[model samples]
Target: MALFSFYNVRKPRQYNHTPIYWDPRKEALEERIRKNKRELGMEEPLEDYKPQIKGTFVEGTSHLKRSYNRGEDTRARKYKTFKFLLWLVVLGVIFWILFFK
Candidate 1:
């Protein structure tokens, strides 16, 4: 009987990578040149307009909206609270009967 299993074990693969050189000063200089050309009317400005994508988290998840809409009406809120409490009492009684009695 084999105390240890070598069939499931394998050597990790070697990774060979060549690092690329980057110059932040050169990149900044290129950006500054583009901005100067745009300011001087030598190059047309690139339209980088982004549309607004804003929405309330409450609106996105409708459970909040449902509760909020119901809350605006006093009668609806009372009825919902009453219904929840009634269910809670009923479940409590059932649990008590099963476990204690």
Candidate 2:
């Protein structure tokens, strides 16, 4: 038989509960709008004017796709060259520090 009960082991307590408070000024403004609508007895508001379009606007063409792909390839090549030059400079600095110092 066990000498002590395992239930006596203390459980971990939570430490991350942050309380949120409501703003009284926003609530008062919303209540005032509700009171105004009730006094005017308005079911729906007037619709705003919207501009109409005639034709569809095609954003991407075959030429645009080809140009975009070429730009991406040139960017990738430039990034690779920049990374290689950066590593070369770092290695040269390390070599100078080890040999000259």
lDDT of 1 by residue, 1-101 (tens): 87778897767999998659888899999999999999998987675222223336557777767876656455777888999999999999999999999
CA deviation > 4 Å runs, candidate 1: 1-72
> Between which residue pairs do clashes occur in model 2?
none
**TM-score (all chains, Cα) for each model:** 0.32, 0.30
Candidate 2, 98: how far from true, in Å? Answer: 0.3
- Candidate 2 weakest ten by summed lDDT: 49-58
Best by lDDT: 1
lDDT of 2 at 30: 93
Best by TM-score: 1
Query: Candidate 2 lDDT, tens digit per residue, 1-101?
Result: 77778888866997996659888899999988977876686633323222222111212456445645566555776797899999999999999999999
Candidate 1, residue 59: Cα displacement in angstroms equals 12
